[model samples]
Structures are given as structure tokens and as C-alpha cells.
Target: MAETLDILVIGGGINGTGIARDAAGRGLKVLLCEKADLAAATSSASSKLIHGGLRYLEYYEFGLVRKALIERETLLAAAPHIIKPMRFVLPHHRGLRPALLLRLGLFLYDHLGGRKVLPASKGLNLNRHPAGTPLKDEFTRGFEYSDCWVDDARLVVLNALDARERGAEILTRTTCAGARRNGGIWDVELQQADGSRKTYKTRALVNAAGPWVADVLNQVSPHSAKNKRMRLIKGSHIIVDKLFDGDHAYIFQNADGRIIFAIPYQDHFTLIGTTDVAYQGDLDTVSASDEETRYICAAASDYFKRAVVPADVRGTYSGVRPLYDDGSEDAASVTRDYVLNLDTADGAAPLLSVFGGKITTYRKLAEHVMSELQPLLGFSLKPWTARMALPGGDIPNADFDGFCGEMSTRYAWLPQPLLMRLLQAYGTRVDRLLGKAADTADLGEDFGGGLYEAELTYLKDTEWATCAEDVLWRRSKLGLHLPAAAHKKVADWFAKATEIAA
Candidate 1:
């Protein structure tokens, strides 16, 4: 019998990492395993907003919206560097939803979660507002509302880092192969990327496998048919050259009643997307189909003065959302709220399966998971993540701009753009990467566009970044900014680094 762990988390996405961090902070021995790199899937492929789902109001999901709205401020304060306030422009379509209804909805949105830090939504005259410049000339009226943008992939990594710091084992490139009851504990088998097998005993198991939630239940708890209910909805997004000149994002309402966002992405591009379609294909090979790409481009063209075509699309990404099947046939109508299934059948070791959670509500979902398992796990520690900051989020009072000023003074020799990028990605931890270096030459080989060997080494060492994509796309959006030739250089560097380490 191996040493028993208090809990074992069987995913490395946002929900899984959040649970691992929460459990570890509550003084529980925890282990988290991911089949690939952290946030390599749905977690990284999100719309990257921390706001309450404004469109969800149509579904009468007031509670879910309120919870997420409250989390917007909670997450902003917790990680100011990576999460900050942004204004969303909702231009009114004369024949669609009326201005009064929009105002009422925005009113509820503003007050629903006790908003304190973010300003309230207000009416806008598109002709006068700066956000109106890119909009079609007909869009004379609009509404500006508040939301926060997050580095979704980095958020997952930060949680994993905090979990590791608090004594949880975070195993990337490791899959949870199987699990079975062994007296009062679970004998769990894990398969590493290198084909090695290891087993551990855990009192509780958490199946936060995202899109593969059903697969996990079927593999481990096949007898429990109740746990195998989920609907996979594929959402796709497209990135194009900068469509608008300002930082504000546009929320355009479609004739079909669905809304799409066109937001500033990576400073040099615009990100527009997300078409909801019932997904029934291989989860591992999900990508933006030509239809989805056209749909998003058309959606953007509907609102902007300038037209967006297939040729303008610079990149595309897609993910399958594993939503709880609430007997809804329409994929877009499916609920985004989460459901937790805890199986303690006939005194067997406990297993908790998670389904249908959004990124904005991951922390709350994690805290709720702990509450459900507190009695079974025999832990009485109070919840602490609500107030605690993630790694590099410890700036005084969460003042990100002030901290950036301080960093600029300290790294006066570094270029402003480069310094700002470091402060945004690593926050106060930038010092750890720069160390005692005094100039750009000490940072080592430049992979162009501010990517240097020093930053890559920090990612490989501290963040478990294993590949070029892991560092370029997920860790940072530098992949979009770097030239085509730079990718090979980055990949070669990673290969050489791995060889030396091995």
C-alpha cells in the first residue's frame, strides 16, 4: 500500500487546479495530474473575460450571473496584474432588443453582485463616443458596461503554483489511468508521459476533467450510470488584424439573438468569436471549422464599418465545453452552471465528478467542493482562498499600475514595452527572472519581440512549460507577435533544454 493522499484531483484545468489549491490550503495532502501541459485545452481556449455572463440573463440564471458578477471583483482584486477592468460597448440594434430592456438588464447586472470596484453601466451615444469610430454609421446609440479580462492560462498556472507551494503534487504530462477502492482509500493508477506507471492511495478523488468528464466517470466508476451525463458544446473563435483602435471591446447582437464579442487581443490584433454548436466529434482534435470561421467573421462584419473576410483571419482556436445536460436540445440554451456529483456508494471511497463550470466561477466551485468533502475528509479548516492572493498577486492593495511604476524605476535600463510585458505576465515575480542582471545582454538570446532566454528559462523551471506552444501561446501570447522563423528557434531551444536536463 502506498502512502495515502487526502485528495487526488484528476485534471489540470481551471476547476481542477482551483480545487487542488483550495484543498492544499486547507491542510489536506493533495495530488493533481494532467494528461498534457497545464491549461492546454479548454482553460486556455476561453473568451478570456471575467465578467458575469450578461447574455445569460435571457435564461433567467440570476443566481449564476450574480455569483459570477461577484467573482469578477474578487478575481480582479486577487490578481490585479493579470485581471483588470475593461469596458464593453453594446450597440443597440433598432429592430432587435429595445434600449429600455437593455438598460434594465444592465441595471440588474450592475447591482446584482454588489459591484464596488468597477463603475456602473451607462447609456452611450455612439456618434459621440470614441468606441463608435469602428462601428457602422447606423449604430447611433449604445451602452457601455464593465467587465474584466484575464490571462486564463496563467490563472491556472498560478493556482497550480500556489497548490505546489502549499504541499500539493502537481504532475503535468501525467494521466489518471484508473482507480479502485482499497478498503477505505482509493488505489489510483497514473501513467506518465514517458510510459512509466505509478500508483497512489487517496481518500477522495475529484474528476474535474472538463470536456472528458464523462470519460473519467466511465473509466473509473463504470457502475455509476448517474455520473455519465454531459453535453459537449463546441465554441470557436477567430483572431484578425486590429479591427478597432481603442481598448474597448464591442458586443454585437446577431439576428438570431446570439451576441458575439470583438475584443482587442495581443495589442496588435482583434479577437472575435464564439459560435455555439453541438459537438459530437473527437475532443482531442477540436478546431475552428471553416463554417465557424465564416460565422465569426460575418458576425464581426455585421457591426464594424470595415468588413472582415476569411483572408483577414490571422488565427483560430476552438474548445468543447462539457456542460451539464439539463434536457435541453439547443446547444446554446444549455446551462453554464456547474453540478457536483459526490459518489459514496455503500461506504466506498468518495469520488466527486465536476461538470459545466465557467472560468469566472471556478474559485467558488472549488470552495463548494471543499465544503462538500469537509466531513468525509475530516477537515475543519475554514475557506481561505477568497481572501488570499495567487502567486505574484501580492502587490500592496492590488494596485497594479503603482507596482508597474515601481518596477520601471527598478529596471530603468530595460525598454518600456519589454518591462510592461514582464510586469503584466509575471507581476512582482519579474525580479526572479531578471535576477541581478543589469542590461538586455545579460538576458541571453532574444527570440525577437521581447522574448528572451531568461524568461523562457523561468517558464521552463517554475511554470512546467515543456514545449514552444506551452510557453508561446498559453504562458503568453507572444506566438502571435513573433515572426514565423522564431518558432523553430524557440522549439530548438526547448529540445536542447530538455536534452540537457535529461
Candidate 2:
């Protein structure tokens, strides 16, 4: 007989993993299945910020802003290693958005939702202040504010890890081929990773499929509800050589009211993006198109003194946001907040579908969802994820600097850059990745860009990375720094490893 579960969740994106953790922590037996590797979708292809989308203010999404603002500190406290504060420099122009209006917006942002750890917004005379050193002469005044940056994919994995540690079963590369309702329980059929089929009995089913949410309901759910069509809007991003000589990021407001961000990435690169376009392509094969690249380049070039063009792009990625279409004409205007749909009739099992979610709001969204499921499950479990740490996120005072200093002392032989890379990549969990290795040579292979064989092995063994793309594109952004030759080397290695396994 197959194992029974209190909840069976589909998809391994942030929402799915986050929900699994929250549900399992509440004395519920949970099973989360992903068709591909965890976070092999939109979770990894994000702008990589755990911030209150300041641009969303114009859309009047105050509730989302407040919730996200509160989460800014909550998440920082929850996971300090991967998420940290970043300052954005917004250079102002005389003709564009007047200073007063901008100040009003910033003022609201500062006081909106319980602001504590992060500093509030401040205005600066760019012509006189050092923050304006890289900007053009025409821009005089500017504003700066704080937001948290996240290791997007790792956040997904961390939640999955935490859930598993808390007695939840997370299955990757396992697809829910079909599911049917039997009495009060759900009979779920899963196609396992090793080409085997099995049955599972689940009381409730949660559909957190993200882009494929509707498809999972139509194809996998035996008892389904009619869903209003989800609008699949694709956002694309590009990485290039570091633009300015500063640690702070730049946020530029376009004439069309949409804003662009150019943030320092991986030390030597700057990450710029994201052109919002209505996408009708296959959700799996979404790629950054030439036109979208030009759009992003134009937006960046408009504000920066340096010219941005297609050739300068080091790497590009794209993700489709399955928004709960609110009938917005412009794709950019579509809401980022999530909505939940629960289908529970008098004599049937419950199916909950999650729509449009941001990386910043995944945890709270999970908590809210479990609360909604509370009555059906007949449990009195209150929220408990607020103060808990995700995997290696536990640092003193969430003090990454202090943690890094301590790590530096421990591994005195490793180069500072190399140490920082591993610390940032794996946080306090580096020991598991490194095993008992003593030095650089002990790591299995070197795939340029400081990507060692030890990290790859850990991913393959623990994280269900079947191929190189899972390692290069999803788990790490080494694809941006690796030469084409080095990139292929990884693919070849993965092929060899698979053949050996077979």
C-alpha cells in the first residue's frame, strides 16, 4: 500500500516548497512532488530581490507593499545568510518625476509597514554627495532606500530542506500523472524518478504549480474546479559586466512610469532587466528574445552614462509569471499579489490553487494558506515559521559580516574571494558541501568561476540535479561567467555521471 499524506502539493517552486514547510510544521504529514528539479522554473529566474516592489506603489497595491515591507525584516531575521540589505540609488531629473512627488512616495514607503532593521529612505544632493559619482551631470538630487537581496533558488531549496527536516517528504523529478478522489481521501498516482509508477492516498491536494497551475488542475486533479484564465506574462533579464564602481544599485524611472534596476552581481557583473511582455510561448521553453533584450538595453542605457547594447549582455534568462489576470491592458500593470482558490464541496476532497506570487511574499503566503486549510484539517496549529530559520540562514543577529569573519578564520588557507563565494553560496552549510576536504585540490573538478566539484557533488547527491543546466542555470549563475567551452565541460561531465549511474 502507498503511503498516505495529509497534504500532497504539486510543483517545487517557492510557493510549493514554502507551503509544504508550513503545512508539515503544523503536525500534518505532507508530500511535495516536483516534475523537474526544485526551483527549476520562475523561482530561479527572478530579479533576486526580497523587497517591497517600490514601483508597485503607482499601482496602489498598498496591502502588498505593507505585507512585503513587513516581510523585509521578517525574512531577513528568518534567513540572514542568503537575504541581506541592499541600497538603491535613484538619481533624479528636473523634467521627470518632480522631487516632491518622489519624496511623498518614499515617505510612504518608509512608514508603510513595520519598518525596523533596515534604514529609512533619505534624499541626497547628487551633485555634492558621493552616491552621485557615477551618474551624468544633468542628474542632481537622488534618493536611497533599503531592500533585501536573496539567493532565489536556494530559498526554494532551503524551504524544502527545512520541510524535510521537519518530517515532510519532498520528491523531485516526480510527476503527479493523475489524482482521483476516494471518499474523504485523494488517490494520487505519481510517476517516480526511476521510471516507476506508484499510488498515494492524500486527504487534501494543494496546487502550487506556478506557471503550470491550470494544466495540473485540468490534467492531474480528478475533481477539479473551473479557473478563470491565468495571464502568462513573461519577464526577461540580462547580466553584463559591472557598470558602476559602487556597491549600491541604481533604480531608474522610465518615461512610461515603469522602473529599471541595475544591481551589482557576483562581484564582477551587474544584473539588469526585465522587460514585461505578454507571452504565449511554452512555459518551459521561454527564452529572452532579441526584441526584449533591446527593450531592456534601451531602458538601462536611458539612465546610465554608459551605453548598453545586446553585445554587452553576458547572459540572459526569462520566466513567465502566471498572474491572476485582473484585466489589465498592459502586462506591466498586472498585479504581483497572489490569490487562493479553494474547491471544497459537501462530499469531496479539497483542492487549493495558488496564483501570482512574488519571491518576497512566499513565506507569508504559505502561512496564510495553512491558516485557510486549518478548518478543513481540523487542527489548532498556530503559525510558527516567522521566527524559524531556513537551513543555513541561522547567523548571529543575522550577522553575515560576523559569520564571514569567523569563517575566514576557520579557512585561513582558502583565498578570501573563494571563501566568500562558498560562504555566500552555501552559508553555514558549507561544511556539508566540503565534507572533510582540506584544500582547493581536494575538490573534484574546477569548472571555472570558482565552481568546484565538491559543490556539484553536493547538488547531485542532495538536491536532485540531474544535468548541468540544473547546476549552471538554476542552482548557480555560473552560466554567466563560464566560457562556452567550460560550460560544455559540465554538460559532458553530467552525461558521463548519468551513464555511470545507468
Candidate 3:
């Protein structure tokens, strides 16, 4: 007899993990399966901002903006260590939007979600403000507004970690091969990484496979709805040597009426991004094309004092957003709002497909998903995730600075730079990762770039890290800073560890 589950979620991206966390918190039997490492796709490739989509205001997406704005504070309160408030400096362009219109948009953005916690937007004399130093002399004025910067990949992992701690089974490298309805139950076939397969019965199935949402409905569940469509819009970003000296990020306006941001990244680099191109290419092999690279460079060059060119790019990444197609001719104009498609008949097992969503609103999306499933699953729908801290997010009153001060005092033996990095990555969980280590030597083998054996082992045992990429890329961006030889050492370590376990 196959094991029965109250809910089976397909996808390890933010939505799937978030839904799994919410369902598990509600005391339901749940399991979430991912074909690859968590956040290996679109979720990790985001612009890493928790904003209300200020550009969406031009499209008259007020409701979406309001919802996202509301979620901004909620998410910041939930995970202060991973999500920090950021101020954006948008320079006024005489050739683009007028100062009055910019002011109006910023005003609306400030009040749309009942502004609190973050300061309100204000006009800036860029010629005098510190943010003006990196801009071309022509720009004399700008506006500053509050949003947030986030560790996109870490956000996905934290949700999965919370779900696992709450008794939900999160199976990475496990694919949902197929699912079929057996009366009021769903028989789900999952294929593991080692080529073994298992079938489980689930009372409901959720399709949160991100870019593969449509493929899952069509190929994995042949009987599912066929009316929906997905628009695969590829957004690409580039990393370069630090463009400016300040902590503030710049939102540059282009003649094409699009905006690109140049944000301070990893202390030594600037992250610039995002070209919205309609994509028909392979999803798994997505990369920033030369054309997209040039476009982003040109966009950033327009506002910065120094010109950004393709040669200056240190690294690049791209992801395909699985937007719910709404027949919009332009890809950028497509709705960022999500649509939940519920397909079921005659009280049979329900299949819920999530289409189109942003990272800022993921928690609310999970709450909405549970509300849709509450009556059918007979679980207590009283929402609990809104106030609950995700895993290590529970710092007293959400004061990350205070938490850091306390940790610094407690772990005085650890290097200050390494301690800060660990606290930013693991939050209060650093205590567990550090264990009883009294000094740097106690941290075990140094894998260069401050990555130690103790941290690697914790990642393997708790975070479902299976390989070097999982450790260096998704779990942490240490790959960007680590020496080339350190990469091989990490891989060899993982190989030996796996062999030992086997």
C-alpha cells in the first residue's frame, strides 16, 4: 500500500516551499518534491528586491503594487537578517518622466500599503547628496524611497527549512514523474536521483513548478486543464566591479522607458540587471545573451558617470519567468499578479496550479493557497505564518543589528568578517553551525573564502546540500570569492563524504 499524504507539492522554488511550510504548519501531512536543488531556477535569479514594483505603477497595477508593498514590511519583519531595508535613488531625467509625475508615483508608492517601519520617499538634490557622486553631472535632482534587499536563494531555503522542521518532507533531486487521480486521491509517482521510483497517494496536488508549470500540467498530469498558457520571459543580470561607493542603489531610467538598477553587491561588486526578452529557448541552459548584455550595459551607461560595457562584466545569470499569459502584446506589460487555477470535478482530488508571482508576495500567496484548500482538506485554516519567524529569523523584536552585537560578544574568538557573513547567512542558527567551536581552528578545514568544514557539514546534514554547486552557488555565493583550487577541494570533499556514507 502506498503511503498517503494530505498534500503533495511539486516544485522546490519559493512558491512550492512556501506552500509546503504553510500546509505543514496547519498540521497537515505534506510532502514537497524538487527535481533539482531548491531555488536553482527563477527564484534565485531575481533582482533581489522586496518592492511594490514601482514600474508597474505606469501600467496602472495599483492593486498588485499595494499587495506587494504590504508584503514588503511583513517579510522584513519576518526575516530581518536576510532582508534589509534599502533606499533607492532614482535620478530625474528631463528626457523621461517629469519631476512632478515622479513625485506622484513615489507618493503613491509610499502610502499604498499604509507606510510604516520604512521612511517615506523624499526629493533629493543629487548634486549635494552622496548618491550624486556616481551619476553623470547632468543629473541634478532625484528621489529616494525605501524598499528591501534580500538573499533570494536563502529566502527559498529558509522556507524549506521551516517546512522540514514543521514535519514536512522536502525531497530535493526528486522529480514528480506523473500524477493521476484515483477517485478522491492522487497517485503521485516520484523519481529519485538514483533512478529509484516510488508512488504515494495524495489528497491534493499543487503545481508550483515555476517555468515548468505548464509542462507539469500537460505532461505529468495529462488530464489537467489545458486552457491556461505561460509566457516565458527571460530576465538577465550582470555582476561587475563596484560601480559606486555608497550603500544606496540607483534606479536608472532609459529612453526606451524601461528601468535598470545598479546595486552594491557582495561588498566589492555592483549588480546590474534585467532585460525583458520574450524567450523561446531551452530553459535549463538559459544564459545572458550578448544582445541582452549590451542592452543592460547601455541602459546603465545612460545614468552612471562611468560607462558600463560588456568587457567589464564579471559574471552573468538568467532566468525564465513563467508568467500567466494574458494576451498582452508586450512582455513587460504582462501582469505580475498571480492566478490560481483550480481544476476538479465531483469532489475528486483537487489539482491547484500556481501561475505568475513575485518573491515579495510569496508568504501571502501561501496563505491564499491554504485558504483555497481549507474547506476541501478539513484542516484548521487559522493563519499562523504571518507572525511566526522562519527558522533562524527569530531575533528579539527582529533587531538584526542587536542580534549581531550579541553574537559578536558571544563568539569573540571568531573573525569579525566571518562572523558577520555567518550571521547574515544563517541568522540565529549560527550557534548551531558553530556548535562548541572556541576558535578558528575549531571550525575545521578552511576551504578558502572563509568556508569551513563545520559550515559545509551543517549544510549537508541539515540543508539537503548534495554537491559542490549546492554549497558554493545556491547555499552561498562563496564560489564568486573562493579561489579556483578551492572549488575542486570542495567537490572532492563532497565525493569522499558521499562515499563514506554509502
Ranking by lDDT: 1, 3, 2
- Candidate 1 backbone collisions, by pair: none
On residues 380-419, what C-alpha lDDT tens digit does candidate 2 reach at each position? 8899999888888888788999999999998887889888
Clash count list over all predictions: 0, 0, 0
Per-candidate TM-scores read 0.99, 0.96, 0.99
Q: Which portions of model 3 miss their true places by more than 4 Å?
A: 223-228
lDDT of 1: 0.93
**Model 1 deviation from the true structure expressed as Cα RMSD, one decimal place:** 0.9
Q: Which stretches in model 1 have alpha-carbon errors above 4 Å?
A: none
Q: lDDT score, residue 132, model 3?
A: 94
Q: Which pairs clash in model 3?
A: none
lDDT of 1 by residue, 1-502 (tens): 4578999999999999999999999989999999999998999999999989999999999999999999999999889989989999999999899999999999999999999999999999999989899889999999999999999999999999999999999999999889898877899999999999999999999999999888999998898775657889999999999988888888989988888998899899999988899988998899999999999888888888999999998999998898999998778889999999999877779999999999999999999999999989889999999899888898899999999988989999999999998988888898999999899999999999999999999999999999999989999999998998999899999999999999
- State the lDDT of candidate 3 residue by residue for 315-384, as single tens digits: 9999999998989898888998988988776788989999999999899899999999988988875999
TM-score of 2: 0.96
- Rank the models by TM-score, top first: 1, 3, 2
On a 0 to 1 TM-score scale, where does candidate 3 land against the true structure? Answer: 0.99
Best by lDDT: 1
Candidate number with the higher lDDT (2 or 3):
3
